[model samples]
Target: MTQATAADAATFAVAVPALGPDVRCHVLQPGRPPLFIEPAGERLLDRAQFRQWSRTVRPALDALILEHGGIVLRGFPTAGTEDFADFIEQFPAFDGGYAGGRAPRETISGRVMEATRLSASVRLAVHSEMAYRRDYPRRIAFFSRKTAEVGGETLITDVRHLAERMDPELAGRLATLGSRTAINFGPRRDADDASYAHMDERGWNQSFHTEDPAEVNRLCAERGLEPVWHEDGSLTVLNALEPFVVHPQTGRKLYRSILHMLPQVENPEQDLERRKRQKYPTGATLGNGERLTDAERAHIDQLCDQTTYSWPWRDGDVMVLDNLQVWHGRNPYQGTRDVQVALLD
Candidate 1:
């Protein structure tokens, strides 16, 4: 899709009078994703004013995210985690919480987390947050505390666009067969240990935030995951997920798979050797027990890239997204890049 017209992007401003005459809104690039909103001048809103503004625009903000997939609030006076948490508190928290989340992140405060602890060299794949889970957040917000010197743009893509671009045959197969995702959690290895071979690796105890196996199993059951125990105290959870879904509010069909986030096979034929050689701790297979070929994956990646949009992070820049409609990822970067995130239902 082409970039939306200025009038299309200004709908939020028309609806939310509290945006003030000094604030400006526009699209980022070839597309209108993450509609950019910032102060038109040097005048910045204080914490109190920012909170009040957020409260007044909450209804419009929801509509904007649903329409644009994401939005970035730049030039806001956000100093630290407190300011970020305060801004997020204005929105309803996801009551289900992030108990079974797979990201290797640290919780900085209430409903706030350090985005990820992965190496800066690792480029994250674009996928909806927690799409594999039975109970996933409907919305997610991100905050950038420090911008990377070289790269590290938070990538986003509209799922509707991606679904539209997908091959009809593959899309139909996915819709009919769905997909099965599995995550393996071995005993926690030292972060610096060379044996740390898997992405986002964590012990089952750490993953479920509990010491008891029964508690972990209970959590898995509640989250629609089937847990399997290994002899070495490792745990593997399996879940079957629909690759396509209808948006609850919009009634639009969305491509909701996380195939890009997992290890993929290069060969079209699924064999025992390929399965054994899979290196990632997490992987997915077609619901019919077939693996997706790397060629097919490349096509999907291209579709995502064709619609993907990103912007360099600035200090205190906040991005809010409709998780069901948008897919998010990261680009490999150099230097220190600090980003925080919050999830909401």
Candidate 2:
């Protein structure tokens, strides 16, 4: 039950590309890229073998992940949600639930939930999960239940790397302002779910998992969110967030929510403009409530674009990410893709 380890930290560290600051995607394969460990003889890991891996390699796996920021566990047997949950048990999860959740997710089993219900055509902007909320998960994990025929590859960026490369003034402003955003949830369902879609809007009751308003207020207060009840029987949540968060592991400030709240008007189309009228449309601002300048936005876009890299999804591949160090997003695709997600506090 011996698992492999890198000879030195330099080789194991994610290498930055020579041509550009961007780190190229690591397309994992069988019996290659020493990072992809094949336990149980290059096949799906069996229960007993996985147990041994848990006992022996857990510390090394965590140490490697700490140095690498993220790790992919493939060639491991995960036929369904239960198996995936069992595999996840080896790595200790952070405490807390999805208090300030985004996306339409159905909890399959244990903590495993659907990644997002956003439309297939939508081009997702990269951002850390629950970045705008007061409390966020330290680790984000994804399990690929299905792989698309074409496209549908997830784009991930190492915020740890991007932090040093970002423009200093912008980073300073974000550090001071943190960032603030507001979301207004109307009583009725969002008629337009696709365009400007932020998260699953099943109604406040379902989101809070309670029908009582008093209890809902209590929960909202705990999360540092302001709950405003509209006359039309709708609720609006205003959240004050910091754009740059210090990584728990590295303690370096990393840019966050830039993509989630980049308040640019892409088109003058009716739908896009209509979403603008709503209070809850995703947006970003300085801690002082001043808007980010044009130059700052452009610089952020350049950095974000350069840092993004994607790889095709393979069935049954699971990825564990340090939420504070990496940002994840969805890319448009054809055919079908089924990815289940579970965020551990």
Candidate 3:
């Protein structure tokens, strides 16, 4: 077979023989709408095959994305028991794993691990993982190795949708309030006896720590978060701001902003201070300024809840999402569950 040229590569299309009507592909940008790539039939690409394909097609895949924004990869092999690390490495943007900083007890580190374990209980409320960090991931991917015995479900919310639906007054308030977050990594409580008492604990604190407090202050003042000390001892700082980031290639606003810390709603200051006085370990502060109030807190929660969506687990299903645009969470489940994860810069 002859090698394909740049022009040929630009127009090259991979024949996906195993996608259904329910699976849709979107260009992930504005201007031109998404182009549908219909598969000839349902087909599955195993790990070895996918790896081999990546070796020769990565460059072409990159070019395709440059021209089309994104692609919905379907027909990948899965078994409740297949090794996924190889497949994850083939797709850098869809690697499932954890990046550790604050939490030491349960630092998740690879695609296979993230794929098989239950990170949090399904009944737990929905939240974006690692929202407290300043440089959080911009994309997320999950592969279901097994379905839950009972009520496990995955929910996803398009934050952009929320932004569009937001009341102008509420949006203005949140934009002005910015956000703050305090993370704890120590045991919830010590064991009953001395055996566990006085253990060397670990944790971290993340707030708007910057060289210019005035600038931070100016950004959050209108949000009503003026560095108030909580009865529990922690202090609350807020930053309200927005970036009009335009996708260089697409020339469209990304509209990916949120008050993930939910400072005004959770009021972690008091609890955080109490934990500090208790001598628990902690580290780091990441913020851009902004605070919240009771009213603002309620509004934000309502908005997030309304925008949330879920991806139910199947024994061998892989789900990929635009982290910047989609918010995800887990549903309650029964019995043991396993998951693996990885991240790409």
For every model shown, the clashing-pair count is: 0, 3, 45
Rank by TM-score, highest first: 1, 2, 3
lDDT of each: 0.75, 0.64, 0.42
Q: Give the least accurate 10-residue stretch of model 2, judged by summed lDDT.
A: 16-25
Model 1 residue runs over 4 Å out of place are: 1-18, 41-44, 188-197, 264-281
Residues 263-312 of candidate 2: C-alpha lDDT, one tens digit per residue: 22223364366566665554655657677778777777677787676766
TM-scores for all candidates? Answer: 0.87, 0.81, 0.56
Pairs that collide, model 1:
none
Each prediction's RMSD to truth: 4.7, 7.0, 11.1
The digit string of per-residue lDDT tens for model 1 on 1-345 reads 343457655333322344666667766553457777877675557777777777777787788788888888988888688899998998888887776576666578989987876667667778888887778889999999898999999998877767777889888888888898877776644342221224435676665677789888888888888887867677778899998888999888888887654532223244234346434236777888787788888889888888787766799999999998888888988888889999987
Which digits, one per residue and each the tens of the lDDT, describe model 3 over residues 205-270? 212322343543453453333333344433343322342234444454534443433211123455
Off by over 4 Å in 3: 1-47, 52-75, 80-82, 93-124, 187-291
Error of 2 at 66 (Å): 1.4
Instruction: Choose the strongest candidate by TM-score.
Output: 1
